[model samples]
Target: MSQETASWVRDVLAGRAEPVEPRPAATVMLVREGADPGGLEVYLLRRVSSMPFAPGAHVFPGGSVDRRDIDHEVRWAGPAPAEWARRLGAAEPLARALVCAAVRETFEESGVLLAGASADEVVSDTRGADWEADRTALIDHSLSFAEFLDRRDLVLRSDLLRPWSQWITPLAEVRRYDTRFFAAVLPEGQQTRDVGGEADHVAWMRPAEAIEGWRSGAMAMLPPTVSSLKDLAAYATLPGVMAARRTIVPIQPELREVDGEVRLVVPEGVDYPL
Candidate 1:
C-alpha cells in the first residue's frame, strides 16, 4: 500500500476516522462467445483517471441505483421482483432497483439495452439518432428509466440477468458502494460503441487475458474485479456461466497492517493474488 493508504488504515483502525456508509450500486459482466469453441469474452471499461471512484481501473458497466429505478411502474418480464428479492437476499423494491440499475448502466456505459418490445424478445438494434437522444437523457438524469421504457413500450428483461455476487467497499475507502454483481450475455444484434463518458477506453477481452494483464501490471483492478475475473475464467461458455447457480453473499475486505504495509484482508475461500 502507499503511504496515504497506510495512514488511512491506521487512522480508521484507531477510531480517529469514521467510515462512510456504502451506497447501494449494481454492476454487470456482459459476456459473449468468442470465435474459438467454448471461449467467452467480457466487456470492460477503463475509467478516466479524473473520476472520483476507481479511477484508471477497468470495470464492468454499472452505477448507483436511482430513485426512479425503484418505481414499480416500469415494465417487466420473466421472474417477478419478489423472486429477484429472494435471489438477491434483498427487499422487492431494492431488488427491482438493482436490476433496473444494472440494465440502465449497461446501456449508458456500453450502448447495450437489456430490454425488448415483448417478454420473449430483445431490442435488436439500439442505434440511430432517436436512440442516442434517449440515452443521452438517461445519462443526464433528465429522463427516468421507467419513463424511457414506457415511452418506448419496452419491457425490462429480468430473465436476461443472472445474479453473480455482492461486494462491499472496504471501510478504509472514502467512497464506498454496496455493489451487486450480475452476469448477462450480450443480446444478439446489439454491439458496444465507444460511448465515451465515464470511461476513456473500452474493449472485449477473454477472462484469462484480463487476468494476465492484471498480473503483468498492465491493468489496474480492485480485488473484487480480480476475483470476479478469476472466477469467470473458470467458465468455458456463456451459457455455462449464465446457467450456474450462485449464492449471493456479501464480501467485504478489511484493512490490516502486516510487515509495515497495509493490506486488504479478504475472507477465507475468497482468494486473489495480490
Candidate 2:
C-alpha cells in the first residue's frame, strides 16, 4: 500500500479519525431485456469526471433523498408507509421518503416514472415537453416531488419498487451516503435518456457486461455497484428476481492495507471484488 494509505487505515482503525456523517441516499436498478437472452439488462450512467462524488464511475440512476420527499402531501398508492417502514427497518417518515425519493430520482435522472394516474396503471410515455420541464425542475429542486405528482394527478407507486440492499459510504471518504438500493423493471413505452447534471453518457447494459468491463479496467464501478451486479448477473427472469425476499442489512466497507496494497474490503462472504 502507499505509505499514505497505510497510515490513514491505521489512524482510522485506531479511532484517531471519525468518518463523516453519512447522509441518506437511494438508487434503483432499472432492468429490462436486451443483451443476454437468458439474463436481464440494466440502465447505467457515467458520472462526469468533475463530479464531487464517484467521478467517472458508472452508477444506477439515483441521488440523496430530498427533504421534501417526506412531504405527506404526496399521493401514495400500494404498500402503506408503515409496512414499508417495517420492511426497510426504518421509521415511517424515512421509509415514505425513501420510496418517494426512489421514484422521484429515477424520473429526474432517467426519465422513467414508476408512477401512475391510478393505482393500476403506469404512464406509458414521458417524452412530452412539459415532462422534460418537470424533470429539469426536479433536478434543480425548484419543484418538489409531491407538487409535481399532485399537479399531474399522479400517484406514487410504492408497490412497483422492491427493496434490494443498503450500503454506506466509507468513513475514510469525505463524501458519504447511507444509500438504499431498489430494483424495478423498466416500464414499457417509457425510455431512459441521458439526463442529469453529471451523467454525460447513458446506456441500457447487461450486468455481466458491465462487470466484464470493470474486470478489464475499462469501466469504473464502486464496490456496492460491483457487488450488486454480481448478484444481479445470477438472475434470468424479472419475476424470479422480484419474487425473492431480502433482509435489509446495512453494509459499510472498510479500508485496509494488505501486503502493501491498500484496498476497500467488504465483509467475509460478501461477494465483492476490490
Candidate 3:
C-alpha cells in the first residue's frame, strides 16, 4: 500500500476517524540573559503543519508523556515527584513522568541542555552529533531517558525547573493536552538552536512583543500560549518571574461560545495556562 494509504488506515484504526481526546502534556519555557533587566526571551517553536495536533502553531517545546517516562529512573532535584503529583492533582507516576517529559522535550526541541553541573562545567565542548543520535534513538523508542542519563552519568537537574502553571485544553477540540508549564533559565553558554524538525521555525522574543506580534497578525499563537505570554510580560527579571510563579494559581478556563466563536474565559486574579 502507498504511504498515504497506510497512514489513513492507521488513523482509522486509532479512532482518528472520530474525535481526538485530551491527553496529558508538558511545556518548558527557557529564559536567558539579555541586554535589559526584563530581557527575558522565551524559546518558541512553530510546529509543522503536517502534525496531528496544534499543527502550524508557535508553541513552547512540549508534548504528551510516553509510558517510558513513567518507568524511567534518573537522579532528580526539586520537589519530589509525589509532591508535584499532589499539587497538580494527578497520579504520582503520571506527574513524575510529565516532569521528565518536560525536561526531555526541551532538550530535544532546542539544542540547549538544561541538565548539567555548574554552568561553568557545561561550557566544555561536547559532541552534538552524539547527543542528536541519542535523542533520535529515544524518540524512536530504542532508548529510554533513564538509559540515556545513566550512559552519560548525568542528573535530571530538577532544581533548574520551576512549575509555572497548568492548563487543560477545551473539551470541544478534537485534540487536547492536560499540559503543565515549567520555567527554566537557560544554562550558561548553552544556546538554543532550531533542530527539531517538528517545528518549522524558532525564535527568542520577549513575552510582550510576542503578544503584540500576534495582535498585529505578524504571528499566530494558540490561546493558552497567548495568555501565558501576557502573564510573563508583567515581570521584568528572572528573579521576578520566579517570584511571581510562586503566587500563580492554576486556572483552567471554561470554554464558551461568544458571537459564534469559541473562547476561553478564566476567572480574574488567576493564572491561565498557556
Against the reference, the lDDT scores of all candidates come to: 0.92, 0.88, 0.73
Which candidate number would show the highest lDDT if scored against the true structure? 1
Please give each candidate's TM-score: 0.96, 0.93, 0.83
Clashes of each: 0, 2, 1
Largest TM-score belongs to which candidate?
1
**Tens digits of lDDT, candidate 3, 1-274:** 2356345435544557643476888898887755676478887888898888777888998888887788647556667888878766678998789888988888778865556643223422233899888877777879887887777767677667788877776544545678888888887767777686799999999988888888887787877788888877777788876665453355555555567444557656654433
Give the residue spans of candidate 3 off by over 4 A: 1-21, 117-127, 245-250, 254-274
Between which residue pairs do clashes occur in model 1? none
Ranking by lDDT: 1, 2, 3
Q: What is the lDDT for 152 in model 2? A: 92
Candidate 1 ranges beyond 4 A from true positions: 1-8
Q: Which one wins by lDDT: 2 or 3? A: 2
Worst 10 residues of 1 by lDDT: 1-10
- 213 Cα displacement, candidate 3 (Å): 0.7
What is the C-alpha lDDT profile of model 2 across 1-274, one tens digit per residue? 3467567667776689776789998899999877546678888999999888888999999999899999999999999999999888899999999999999999988999999999998999999899999998888889999899998999999989999999998767667899999999988898888775879889887888899999999999899999998878888888866886888999998876578566787877677755
How far residue 91's Cα lies from its native spot in candidate 2, in Å, is: 1.2
